[model samples]
Target: MAKLVQFDRLGGPEVLTLRDVEVRAPGAGEVRIRVDAIGLNRAEIMYREGSYFDRPVFPSMLGYEAAGVVEAVGEGVDGLAEGDPVAVVPAFLQSAYGTYGDHVVVPAAAVVPRPAGIGPVPAAAVWMAYITAYGPLVEAGQVRPGDHVLITAASSSVGLAAIQTARHIGAIPIATTRGAAKRQRLLDAGAAHVIVTDDEDLPARVKEITGGAGVRLAFDPVAGPGVEAIAQGIAPGGTLVVYGALDPRPTPLPNAHSYPALTSRTYTLFEITKDPERLRRAVAFVNAGLASGSFTPVVDRTFDLGDIVEAHRYMQAGDQVGKIVVTVTHDAASD
Candidate 1:
């Protein structure tokens, strides 16, 4: 039997229930894995609250990423075998079949061979955080050498990854947080400049850092009163990428009647995973970076699978510096 986290009707984290399920053999082009660790994303919270882009299906799984070992491979599945370590990209079925389970059965194409040096815990933490950051900073934003990049909500896992990715691409990173407590942490995470938005003017600090030219790229997750503020920090013709909605309020765009035009976009990892080739490339890029030590998964906390309710409670507090993970025991290796 496989233990999985699921919910029938959702209101709060308390609605999640852990139940045992039978593990069936994989069908053609599918694979079965003994899950080791699962990555938790803010999207899950929105899904639970009935506010995400996708509506939840009752009795659905609630995880987005996981790392495990292949326990079985179905016919016609190439390049994979039992006992191989792997990381899953759960881009499809964003509303169902999440990673919070003891075992997962997914299409073979969605599985990526994980680096041997990276353990299940850290590997599970990589996909969503890095992909969200990589797509905006490298793919969409096109951050170039010497370009200034501004990141809002700089203390999050995706935000931290954006900072590091920007530095790797030789761009100058300016980060914004709610207060001064996270300033040192952001700096250590490779931010060249940090601003406490409440105390310092975000646009002013960004202009000062960029010699009044403004940043070439702005990545924002918090969208509400500061939407225009984020745009003001970006240079004319710069890209402003919005990926997550941490704030419940609607993000207001600059009134065309008053403000100059800027390229604004809302991006999601779903777009990158729409094609199998793109998904493969993204997974390869992330794994390569992980093996080379250019990318690191910042684990904020890990909860036992049974304590997921507490995990959600802690995540809602909004103090975590990076990814929150759930640890689970595999059926084959019960200790």
Candidate 2:
């Protein structure tokens, strides 16, 4: 029997329960994995609160990304066999194959070979946050050399990835957070300039950093009233792409009269994964970045499989400095 985490009803962290179940063999084109490490994201929190755009059925298993060793391979699966170490991509699977379990079945396309010299915990934490930021900064925004970039929520894992990516593209990475505590950390994390919004006026600081030219692109995860403030900071023809709604309130539209040529749009993984070619391209780009160490996943806290309740509590506290992880097997060195 495989011990797995499951939720029967949508509510709080209390709704998540552990259970033992028969481990089924994989079918054609599928592979079963013995999970080593699991990546935790805010999306899982939204899933439990029943507020995520994607809703799971009752008794659903919850997890999106993991790194594990292949235990069994079904017919027609190629390039992988039992005992191969791999990392699952950000593709969502059915409840039957969720990554929260000791064992899971996933399609071959959903698994990627982990790059050399990266440990399982960090490899497990790589896919979701890195790819989410990669799609916007490189693919959508078309960030180029000498462009000025502004990234909000600059302390998150995705926010850190954007900083490195903008640096790679030769763009000046100017990041923002609400407090002074993370200013030095973000600057050391590759941000060319870090602004504490609560301490200084955001738009004015951005203008000063860019020499009154304004940023040409803004990547925002926090939306709502802040959207108007961010919109006003962009150059006359700049673009604002919002990926996550940390704030529940509706986003106020950019003032058309103030900057008639400014453009803004909301983005989600759904839109980026809509086409097979685009999804394949995104996966390849992230894999390449991992191979080159141009992108690295940061882990702030790790929970044992049995300690998910505590993990949820820590996540809700909102003090995390990087990606939170869960492991099926304990590692003393993780501390």
- Whole-model lDDT per candidate: 0.84, 0.82
Per-residue accuracy of model 1 over 40-97 as CA lDDT, tens digit each = 8888888888888788888787777889999999999999999999988756675645
Sliding window of 10 residues with minimal summed lDDT for model 1: 326-335
Stretches of model 2 off by over 4 angstroms after superposition = 93-96, 272-274, 330-335
After superposition, the stretches of candidate 1 with alpha carbons farther than 4 Å from their true spots are: 255-260, 331-335
Give a tens-digit lDDT track for model 2, residues 1-335: 67778898888888888788888898998889988898888888888788888788877888888898898999999899888999887676434457886788877767877777877799888877777777877888888888889999988888888887888778999999898998998998899999899899888888899898888899999898888778777988888989898999998888777653677988776555545577778778877777877777778889998988888888877787778889897344531
Query: Model 1 lDDT vs. the true structure?
Result: 0.84
Name the lDDT value of residue 313 in candidate 2: 82
Cα distance off (Å), candidate 1, residue 271 = 1.4
For candidate 1, report its TM-score.
Answer: 0.95
TM-scores for all predictions: 0.95, 0.93
